[model samples]
Target: MAATGTARTAVDSVMAQLSALEDPKMRAVNERHGDDYGVNLSRLRAVAKELKTQHTLSVQLWQSGDTAARLLALLICRPKSFEQDELDAMLRESRSPKVQDWLVNYVVKKSPHAEELRLRWLSDPDPVAASAGWALTSERVSKSPEGVDLSELLDAIEVDMRDAPDRLQWAMNTCLAQIGIAHPEFRNRAIGIGERLEVLKDYPTPPNCTSPYAPIWIAEIVRRQAGE
Candidate 1:
């Protein structure tokens, strides 16, 4: 009972703090991405820094079902401590795109069980879970492409990217770009796959930001790497 009380008190305090930090404009932007939060990411990181790593408190915060709180939980949580099933459940519960992305990148990516979960999530019927899996795949493709079959990935992307749901499409696109950027042998082929599919080609991009269009994105990144 004492532990429960302490956890409850900590959760309430943090939730109240998050509520106080809400920004209307940030909330509007987040809402457009299927999330609802106003606490700026930098401010959120500051909050996490103060709390430090508290795995139990992070679990409690995660159970609260608030997007900002969940983000905070991820920041403070011990990444390697979670069981694979627990991470799976968390991803399933993550309806907010921001939460899902952060959970996969910040926590799951650092876990020891990353590969196991990545393989399972890749074949998951749920697109969101599959997207997280693809995000992991992209990480491996760029950093550790030893066992990754680049050609097979391209074949899959060529067939599926155009019809994939928003989240999965974005992840696959990242993988495609990673292949092109990291592997000289596959650069042309990756660009070819991207061009043929034309995914995100027409997507509006803000001024000065690189477009997500793969062929252009690949060439620009490769150019910058060679001191263009």
Candidate 2:
């Protein structure tokens, strides 16, 4: 009873703090990314720092269904404490790009079920889930290429990337770039596929930032790795 009561108090207190931090202009900017709240990451991190890790409080915040609260929940929660299905449900429930990105990066990556979920998500018809799969695959491509079928990944990217939805397309492009950057064998093929697909070819990249265009992205990262 004491633990439960503490969880409730924590949830209520954090919710109020989150409400006080809301900003209309920030929300307007976040809305472009499908997020509804405006508390910037620095402020959000400060909030998380105070709360520390609290799984029950995180669950309540996630249940509240506010984007900023969900982001905060992700930061303050114990990542590997969640069950596989719970993580899957959270990812699906995450409507905002920020929420989904945070879940995958901060939570799922740390979960014991990561590989199982990664394989399942890769074939999921939902673009967001599929994007998660690709994102995980990119990690594997860079870190553990022993068993991954790099050629098959490239073949799929070649056939599907040009017409993938916005978020999925970006994820697929990242995987393609990762393959080229990590493996010398597939570098030429990945670059050729990116050049042909022209994915993110004309993206409005800010000056001094690496372009997301996969070929350029791949080339630049590789150049830096070689101390060029």
Candidate 3:
């Protein structure tokens, strides 16, 4: 959608706000993750609050190519109006893992076409699409599992996980943990798969955070949920 003159002015104002709050140190950190923004999340949200017209401004900001602005744009964009081609373009252009995560959670998952995209992208050869597909599946299993085939998911995890790309591996591991925690009937089976895969078994985890190692993470979550 083309931004009107007034909308362009509003976008420019918001960009100015973001630029004023930019932090060089934060920008350096973001650069490590492939994002080119110097602005912090809090500052971006502050700008988002000031610019209430999300849909209009999102279009302009997304076109600006500023990392912070694009993140804000995703927050304000109308999920229902988001098209598949636009989403595909965003995913293709996303180099930062953080941006991809926001796109999956804030935009794609909230869209009306989420399930359709999820099913199609899960098998897509592109790593970005496939990773988003797995991430969406993980979210679905956490909230609702009515139609999802647990058996099929488990089978895929068993067969494809070791050979999956880095991003998809993380999502698959999370999916395994979600299944174990959300469906008690599948807890043992999920645990067995985790044991066999040993995914993230040797990966370091920060203190106070659950290890991404599926078996340990699943067991810890299950224990806590059971009031242990």
Q: TM-scores of the models, in the given order?
A: 0.96, 0.97, 0.92
What TM-score should be assigned to candidate 1? 0.96
Kindly state the number of residue pairs that clash in model 1.
0
Off by over 4 Å in 3: 1-3
TM-score top scorer: 2
Give the C-alpha miss distance for residue 24 in model 3, angstroms. Answer: 2.0
lDDT of model 2 at position 211: 97
Q: Tens digits of per-residue lDDT for model 2 on 26-47?
A: 9999888678888878999999
lDDT of each: 0.93, 0.93, 0.85
Give the Cα error of residue 95 in candidate 1, in Å.
0.2
| lDDT (Cα, tens digit) per residue for candidate 3, span 1-228 | 354777878878888888898999988988886778788787677767776657867988888877788889888888789888888788878777777889889899888888988898888888878888888899889997879998899999999998888888988889989998898899899999999988899998899999998888988988887798
On residues 1-228, what C-alpha lDDT tens digit does candidate 1 reach at each position? Answer: 998898899999999999999999989988987898899999999999999999999999999899999999999999999999999999998899989989999999999999999899986889999999899999999988888888998888888889999889999999999999999999999999988999999999999888899998999999999998
Better of 2 and 3 by TM-score: 2
Clashing residue pairs in candidate 3 (N, C-alpha, C atoms within 3 angstroms): none
Give the TM-score comparing model 3 with the true structure, all chains together. 0.92
Error of 3 at 84 (Å): 2.8
